[model samples]
Target: MFFASDNSGPVHPRIMEALMEANQGHAMAYGADALMDEVRARIRDIFEAPEAAVYLVATGTAANALALATLAQPWQTVFCSPVAHIHEDECNAPEFYTGGAKLTLVGDTDRISAEALRAAIEAEETRGVHGPQRGPVSLTSVTERGTVYGLDELRAVTAVARDYGLPVHLDGARFANALAALDCSPAEMTWKAGIDAVSFGGTKNGCMGVEAVIFFDPAHAWEFELRRKRGAHLFSKHRYLSAQMAGYLRDGLWLDMARQANANCARLVAGLRAAGMEFLHDPQANMAFPILPLRTHRRLHEAGAAYHLWNGTLDGDDPDQPIAARLVCDWSISSDEIDCFLNLLRA
Candidate 1:
């Protein structure tokens, strides 16, 4: 059983088949491919933003960094939660892409409150030109802690940003998973919630490596294109990227995959609860942070299950001591795997 990360899962067969089909014939380069046109049209229709500008990149980092760079200035600062992927996981890519802009972490928790965001923004620029000016506000839907921001929470944070006329960017690396968990429309979770742009994730769902950066207003389109190229994220073989996204959008495959993933996680969570495992955070989507006895951890590890240990170690002194683990479920993870993992934990 592999629960290390959604990124570790295999690409869907449909996506791979689409890639093979796309490779059969040569198409235009640099996002000029016919498939890219279809992908863009599909994304626009899905998001219900007829004027949205959508572009695909190979990595979530590129999607988020380039999108943020388009919305931020060099001397500005991006506000986000301390647990945001852009803050904790991106390793300064956002700062690099924004040309020295800083990240102002909003709150101590995974979910940033509207009051905290307002305070953070207000606290900035007090040093005049010597301090970083407030730039765009970035929100992660399925936050790093695996808890999702509800529709009201999302709107609250975005409303605070909008009050100051700052643009909002959503790091949607788990976009579909969050959408499925919340039962919200793409538009309702994003533009309708005051998000200016989104890093619409596909890699963690089922694509090999494709993420789309969607700008609602389209005014930032040219700037994003330039930033993408300058950041060395532009692919010469752009058709491959387009093909992955096209297949992801085709016939509602993206939603189906997300539903499967969330269902798998739900099953896992239910099983863990039955086994008396304590959760560090609520299992909102496809990711879970559960705390279990170290003996159970060793039992699973020795059984050839792979997952991340969030705290403590396998060889620690007390077998009964609790340790947290980060478990992720992808579309391909079956009910059998979840049951096997739970059985192993009980054993």
Candidate 2:
């Protein structure tokens, strides 16, 4: 049972087929390929933003860093939760890409409240020119803890940023998963909710490897293009990336994949509950943080199950100590596989 990460899942057949088709003939290099035009148009239609600026990159880091570099200045600070991917996971790429701008962690948890965000933003840029000025607010949905943000929660934090006249960037690495769980359209979760830019992810859903950076305001397009090229993220053989995203969006395959992953996570959560496991947070999308006894963890590990431990190590004197772990379900994990994992837990 492979539950290490969604990134470890196999590429979907449709996406692979599309890549095969894209290899049939010669195509223009860089972003000039015809497939990219189609991909851009399709995304625009999906997001309901006719004038939005769309570009593709091979990794979420490139998408987030380049987009933020375009939106923020060097002398400012980006406000985000302490566990935001841009802050904790990107290896300071946002800081480097934004020309030395810093990240001011808004709240101590995966989810940030509007009040906490207001307090954080107000606390910055107070010392004349010595302090960092406020830049953009980056929000992550389907937060690191597996809790999905509701519409009200998203609006509340965005409104706080609006109060400070700062632009808002959404680190949507799990955008599809969040949309599936929330049962909302792309527009409702993003642009309509006051997000200025978004890293629309497809790699973790079912694509081979592709993420799109979308700016609702088209004015940022040229600057983003320059930044992307400068950062070495502009793929010379770009049609492959276009093909993956094209297949992902085709016939709403992205949503179907996300729905299946979320359903798998829900199934796993129910089994964990039946096993009397304590949860670190409610499972909302494809990830869960459950606390199990160290003996159970050892047993699962011995049985060849794959996942990440969030807290506590297996080398402990207390076999009954609670250990927290992160379990993720991808679109490709079967129900039978989930049952096998549950059976292992019960054993």
Candidate 3:
């Protein structure tokens, strides 16, 4: 059973097939491929933003960093939660891409609140030229802790940013998972909620390595294209990325894969609960952070189950002590694997 990360999962057969089909003939390079046009059209249709500017990158960092750089100026600071992926996981790529823009951490938890965001934004740009100016507000759906920001919560936070004339960016590294959990339409969760841009994830769900950066307003398109090219994220063999995304968008496979992953996490959560494990945070999507007995941790490790030990260790002296672990469910994970993992816990 592999639960270390959704990134570890195999690519969907449809995506691989699409890649093979795309390789059969020569295509235009540098985002000029015919498949890319189809991908862009499909994304615009899905998001209901016919005017949206869509571009692909091989990594989520590129998608987020370039998108943020498009919205933020070097003299400004981005507002985000303390545990946002842009803050904790991106290795300051946003800062690099924006030419030294800083990230101002907003809430104490993984999800930011409207009041906290307002306070953070207000606290910035207070010192005039001495301090950083207010920039974009970045929100992470299916936040690092796996909790999703509800529609109203998103609206409130975006409204706060809007009050200060700051643009909004969404780090949707698990967009499909969050979408399935929220049961909201793509448009409702994003532009309608006042999001200016989004990093529409594909890798973590099932595709090989394709992420889309979508801007609801086409005004940012040229700048983003220039930034992407300057940042070296512009893929030369562009059809491969286009094929992966196109296959993902077709037949509603993206949502179906996400639904399976979320269902797997729910099953894992149920089994963990039955085993008397305590959750550090709610399992809102496809990730879970559970605190279980140290002995159980040893048992799972010895049984060849792969996952992240979030806290403590297997070799600690206190066998009965609880340790935190992160379990991620992917679309390909089978129910039998889940049962086998649960059995290991019971053992």
- Given candidate 1, what's the lDDT at residue 125? 89
Candidate 2 similarity to native, TM-score? 0.99
Where does candidate 2 stray beyond 4 Å? none
Model 3 / residue 80 / CA error / Å: 0.7
Give the distance in Å from residue 29's predicted Cα in candidate 1 to where it truly belongs. Answer: 0.4
Best by lDDT: 3
Instruction: Report the Cα lDDT for residue 152, model 3.
Output: 98
Global Cα lDDT for candidate 2 = 0.93
RMSD of each predicted structure: 0.8, 0.7, 0.7
Residue lDDT tens for model 3, 78-188: 998888888888898999999999999997999899999988887887897999999999999899999999999999999998999999999998999999999999999
Q: What is the TM-score of each candidate against the true structure?
A: 0.99, 0.99, 0.99
Q: List the residue pairs that clash in candidate 1.
A: none
| C-alpha lDDT score of every prediction, in listed order | 0.93, 0.93, 0.94
Clashing pairs in 3: none
For every model in order, what is the number of clashing pairs?
Answer: 0, 0, 0
Instruction: Report the C-alpha lDDT of model 2 over 105-146, residue by residue, as the tens digit.
Output: 987888889999999998998997998999999989878888
